[model samples]
Each structure stands twice: as structure tokens, then as C-alpha cells.
Target chain A: MNAQYRHSQPGYLMILIGVILLVVAAFVWVYGLQPLEIILGAIGIFLLAFGYKLTVEIKNGFLRFWFGLGIFWKKIAIEQIVYCEPFRGVFAGWGIRFVWNGWLYNVSGMKAVTVVLKSGKKIHIGTDEPVQLIEAINSVLHGQVGVESTQMWSEVKADYLKRVEQALSVARHPRSFEILADVGNHLDRRFTELEPRQQTWENFQRIITEMGPPSEYAELVNEDKKSGRLKLTKLEMSAIGVLLVVFGVSAYFYPQMPERIVTQWGFHGQPSSYMPKPVGMFGTPVIFAVLVIALIVIPRTASVSVNIEGFRRFYGGLLIVFSIVMLAVQYQIILWNLGIKTNPNVVGIISVSAIIVWMAFRFYRARRHN
Target chain B: MNLENWQTQLRKGLLDIVVLNLLNRGPSHGYEMVQTMKRIDGLAIREGNIYPVLARLQTDGLVTSYSEPSTDGPPRKYFKLTEAGQKALEDMNKHWDQLISSLESIRKGTGL
Candidate 1:
């Protein structure tokens, strides 16, 4: 089969900006840490994730384009494209902005292939090779390309579907229908790609042989389904319990504590924000508990496509980290009330940095695994 | 020292150049490229693996693809070399020629 072709234009400028922000954040952190450093670091990460590059791909008759990690993307069907031409006009600033009539998706440079869709919308795709990109689009619009006969696919498709259904029946998983549909789609694409002479039952059998036995596929699907079921492990539940205990202990100190509690501190380790005795003592713990509970429940209740089970350990670790940080803050608050002076700002900075480092490590490992 | 391993590594290393040289002739699809590679003995390139190579090439801005709608089945994606790809191929060809000549001279005992 003709697989997808992809071209990516690196947003050197955006990447540089991200790098600069990160460097500045690091410098600020080293000199005097503030919430602004965290904000800058966050924006740096966001830019790196979503503004680093622009990629355009020709796949399955769609002209798919995206900017950085596919966070922002658009797809246009080839059939919708009336024509495309090499664009030469006034230079517009880059990174997905509204042009004269339509939108312009560019990472760098003024050279682009402006595609005119059937609905009179024009999309200018920035590319270094504007002429070649236009030529590629034109060839697809006008060229005579070889295609497998639908008649040939029709001959074996029924049998193929039947076999696939039979193969899926043994699994008895709840997601069997979804799996069947996915397998059917894959087989359809595979069958369409086969040469006319190879579009026979015999060749299909050979292909199936290469794909392995039905039992193996069923076993795989069953295993995947089994592993992916969402449930809180003992460790995760224990972490939540520990958090509750920490909050409970903090409540124990309420009677002995002062009228107003130091809930927030400034960069100079001085108390900057305070709350009334009741709200200051219990408010943060209550908010943190609610946040942790929401974090635990959202993935299970929400319609997230990702298999949360895969990140069960990571998620558990995160909850533990949150609990530990909460414990430290609660302890510091108690100490402050008991006339023990401690820098809560330092504690906050350390906790936040630790979490950031752990997350970065996790992200790096996930990328390496993929 | 393992001849088979050496041959495999050599072929793998040369895949980019080989693919670029193939596309330099004319535009071709993934299957066509794989079929052509299969004809070259010892290349042993798998059909599934060619797409990644093509994708990487495209990502590098050396090649670009567009789909031609098939009369019968799905649209066929065709990849062609860009100007950068052409220049890359020329540079690789020159380097390959130099390497071959150097090896030939050594084989013939024509050392300085």
C-alpha cells in the first residue's frame, strides 16, 4: 500500500523562544524563586510542546497538517481541493493566523502552497519547497495512479469479515465489537493494497498466516482488556488514607493554635497571606483533599481514550507526592502556631521543584519507551 | 568480522541514499519502492519498514507526498524528491563514488 508521506517544518523561532524562557526561568529560580518562575517554566513547556514545529502529511486521501505534537491540527480531503498554487505575496507573520480570505499554517518562510478547497476557502501551507509541494498536489489531482479493483476486494471481503468475526468471537471481551471493527478496517486497507492476482482466498490465507493464528490475536485482545480495567490499588487507597490522617492530625492542633494562621508566605520567608483561625487551619487541607480526590476520580469517570491502568503506578506516585507535600505544609503550619519559626516558602519551592523533576523524568522515560 | 551482519548493516546504512536515488528517477509509492528494493539481493528490506524510512525522509523535507485517488480502491500516496533531496542524492553519490574508488585502489594494491 501507499503509506503516508509527511513533512515537518521546524519552528526554529518558537523553539528558541521556549529555550530562552526556560533559561530565564532557571536563572530566576537560582537567584530568587518566585511564582513567576513557575509560570515562565510552564509557558516554556507549553511552547515546546505545541509551537515547536509544523507538519503536513498526505494520508488516506486527506491533507493533514498539524503544529507541534499534533496539539493543533486540520485535515482537508483531497476531493475537496480544487487546485493549489505556489503562493507569492506579502509576507505574513507565521504560526496559524488568518490571511486574506482563509487561514495560513506556516512555521517559517513566505513560500507556501495555497490550496483552494471546493468551499472557496484557501489554506496556505508554508514550505521551503513550495514548487515541489504544488507539483505533488497537482499530480495527485491529475495523474493516473494504479488502484486495486473494487471487484477483486468484493470477492473476498465477505469471507474476510466472516473469518475476522469468528476470530473475534472467541475473545468474549466487552470491547470485542470495537476490536472487530478495527480489525475489519485494517483488513479492508490490507485487501485493497493487494495486487489483483494476489486478491484471492489463497493470498488472504497467507496474509492471515503472517498475522498469526486467530487464537493468538484473541489471547492478545483478552490480555489487553484484562490489564486495562480501572481500579484503585491498595497503595493508592493507602496514600489517600495517609492524606486524610495528615489532615486529621492538623485538625488536632486547632485548639492550641493562634487566632490567625499563616497560610501563605512571601519569597523572603515572611508571612504574606493569612486567614481566619477556622478557614486558615482547615481551608487548604480541605482544598488539597478535594483536588486529590478529583484527580483520582476524573480519569475513571471521564471519557478518556487512554488506558489509565498503564499509568497506575505513576498516578499512585503522584498522589503520594501530593500527600507528602501536604504533610510538610501541615507540619510547618503546626510548628508556626507552636512558636517554631520555619520558612514555608523554602518548603514550597523544594516540593514544587521535586514534583517538576519527577514529572520531567517520567516524560523522558515515556518518550524513550515510545 | 561477521560477513552477514556487515552486509546487513551496510545495506541499512545505505537505505537513505538508495531511497533518494530511486525517487530521483521518478516519483513512486511505498509498495513500489519496497518491490524495487526486494529485487536487489541482500537488501532484504521488509514491506512494512519502508514506510518509516519514507516518513523520515519526508520529515527531513527531502521528500513530499500527495495522494492520487484510485478509480477502484483508496487513494494511492506517491512520494517525490524535493530540491533538497536531489542535492542530498548528488552529494551522497559523489561520496559513494569516492569510497568505491578508494576501496578499489586498495584492492588492486595501488597505494601511495
Candidate 2:
């Protein structure tokens, strides 16, 4: 028994015109046919051959449901369907909407019969007589329990598996095929106990769903590789800020010093070398700023994965040590210009040791969970 | 700590055992098995969710299926547990009992 339902022609007319132009263009280029007449002929052929329509029919004890001039369809073994229900929704403004839930085949109405397949995936046929359609399908489905088609089941499983393997071949993840195979193994074990549907397409879909999208999985894996790397912290930022303030304070004393500033001291604690005042005062901070900025930007631009956690901790610790060294150097230059008798190198050595001791203690305390 | 994610994890953990227990009663197809699982309180097994687990069980030789004529519509592939499956179920039950006892003590706030 076959019953056909056709949606109104207005929706299809727009699509028909769109396809006709492409067909006409192809025909005109290949056969040198006149564009105007070829277009007209194309439209006629399209309407005659593949006009849009929705259909439901009973064939070979299966309720064959399809839509759109037989371009797409699904066949449900009457016994395999548990039930059919009418679904009413916008379904994203409808005319063959492939939404998250399932494929919805509707033209203009809100009413449709949702045919739930035993394996999963639903075929929604939009119809004004949803109740009647449901009754008809149910009547056919409830007629008799016939022999399950093992051969057909095998074919469906084989076809779906092939499609999945093909998609897996070019999937973004390097281990996509392995992941799918593992999932299949898991599924095989679980299904043995559960004894769920033996159908393949829905099973394959479930495997893909569980595994997640290949692109997303690949991105997460990549992110995890980078996540263990280091970054700058609040303590480092505060240390840098304090160093900048000290640099400014030292610069304030620069103008009071001689033109040729004392840069290096001899073993006898005598001024042995001189640089321009600006070089002695500002050179360290300028160099420090450039190095710090480069360090910050290098991580962002580098293609190579950096151990960020280790790098940030090391960088933060080094910044504090280096900042103190810069201040000590600036302090020595100023005191020497002011005629003070002190070894700047000794000042640097003592300050470095003190900072090192302080940092070690702090790190040790932190490690102890204090 | 997303509740839905936690529930999904819990479901995934228990699904294999649930399927095995359902098959222990009698052979049934996938859709029917999902419906039965849904009847249990707090289980939200979707129809699509059961197939891979079934595939996994079959791969492990814990269960087997055969084609049968349905009472109304087309044929159904009905699954039943193998001898290995029965033994596995026993082991699983023992483990489950141990876990339940441990959780019971923890719930009473009397033991680690």
C-alpha cells in the first residue's frame, strides 16, 4: 500500500529556478545551445524529472518514508519501530533542516510525524494529517512479526562501517582511527551485555559522539601540551615596578654628577673608568625594559612549545635578582660621583647573596605549603 | 563539578553492568533494552547511547545475538549472555557489593 503527500509547489519553485540556471549554463557551454531557450528547457526537464515532493509508502513489509522528489528517503522495518509521535516545532524555519536533534523534512506546517528508528536517528515527515499518518504507520508496524533480515542487517552494518572508516582516514587527529577502533571495541563489549540494537549507523554515530569532534579533540591535546609551561606572575610584576621606581630615583641624582661619570672602580677602590652621565644613569633600565618586553613577546610568537611553568618561575626569580643588581650598580655610580669611598662590586656581591638567600627561603616556605 | 557532566560520567561507568543485568533476564533488541533502562529511576539512557556498549560486549565474547521474527513489525536481533558473561556478572556483583559496603561506612562518617 502506498500513500503520497506533496507539499505546496511554491517552496520548490524557487529551488527549481535556481538549479535550472546552472543546468542551462552547463548545457550552453557544452553544446553551444542558446542561453534563453536552454534555460526554459532546463526548467521543464527539472520539473518533469525531479520536482520536490514528500512520500510514504508500504513496500516489502517496510514503511518506506521519503521526501523531496525521492532525492532522500529512509526505510523502516515495520517491526523495528517502537512507536511514532507527532512533533510540532519551528525546527529552524524548516525545508529540509538538518538540525542537532535530527533531519526534519517539512515545507510549511508545524505538524509532523516523528518516526523513531530502533537503531536511533529519526525521520520527521511534515504532514497536515499527522494523526492519520501515525495510525497508518502503526497499523503497518503492528501487523505481524516477520523474519528479521539478517542479510540486510549485515549489509547496513558493513556500509556504515565503511563510511566511518573513510571519514576517519582524513580526520584531524593523528590517532582518530585508533580512537574510533578503541571505541568500537568498547561498544562491542558493552553491547554484548546490554544487547541493544544491532543496527550499525546509530552505533557508529554514538561512537563519534563519545569520541567528540576530531578537530576539537586535537585542539585540546595541543592545549594540554602547552598548559604545563610557565608565565609571569604577580610577585614578578611587583618586583619590576619597585625596580623602575629605584631607577627613577637614581636618575634624579644623575644631573648633580660630573659630565664624565665614574662607571668602574679598581681593586684599590679608585674610579678607573668613566661614561657619559646619561649612559651611567639610564642605560641599565632601558636595557632591562627591552629584555623584559622581548621575553614577554617571545612566548606569544614562538612556534616551539615552551615549558611555561618552569620558564615563568625562573624568569620571575631572575627578574627580582637582576632588578636588585641594577639598583646596586646605579647606587655605586652615584656614590662614586659624590666622592664616597666604597667598593660597588662588593655591594653587588653582598646584595646578590642576600636576595638569593631570601628567595630560597621564600621558595622553601611555599613548597612546604605554608 | 558540572552536575550534567558528572551524571554522564556516572551513567557511562554503570552502563556496561546495567546492560549485562538487563540481558540476564531474557534476550531483547537494543531499543527495547534502552526503554527498560529508562524505566529505572535516575537513568537517562538515550536510544543512541546503547549500541557501542553492545558492540564492545560482543567484541569481548561476553554476549551473543541472533535474528528473530518480531511479534508485529520486522525482525529483531535479540542478545543473550554467554557463559563468560555469566561469570563476569558474578565478579561484577562481588565488586559492587564491596563498593556499596565501603560507601555505606563512609556515608555514616565512621571510616575513611
Highest-DockQ candidate: 2
Cα lDDT over the full model 1 = 0.64
Number of backbone collisions per candidate, in order? 0, 30
| Model 1 chain A: worst 10 consecutive residues (lDDT sum) | A302-311
Candidate 2's C-alpha runs over 4 A off are A1-214, A218-232, A351-370, B1-112
In order, the TM-score of chain B in each prediction is 0.91, 0.93
Residues A125-175 of candidate 1: C-alpha lDDT, one tens digit per residue: 888777666656655664533222333343344455455446545544333
Q: Over the stretch A1-370, how does candidate 2's per-residue lDDT look in tens digits?
A: 3443223322364356546666666665454323223435544454444335556665666766544466445566766564566663334243554332245665544567766554433456666677677666766665433113222333333344344444433322222333333333333333333233544446645643543333332322231232222334575577668667867787788778888887765444555567888887777677777766665555444322122333455556666666666667767767778778567657546554656565555435332310
Reference A-B contact fraction recovered by candidate 2: 0.00
- After TM-score superposition, the amount by which residue A181's alpha carbon in candidate 2 deviates from its true location, in angstroms, is 24
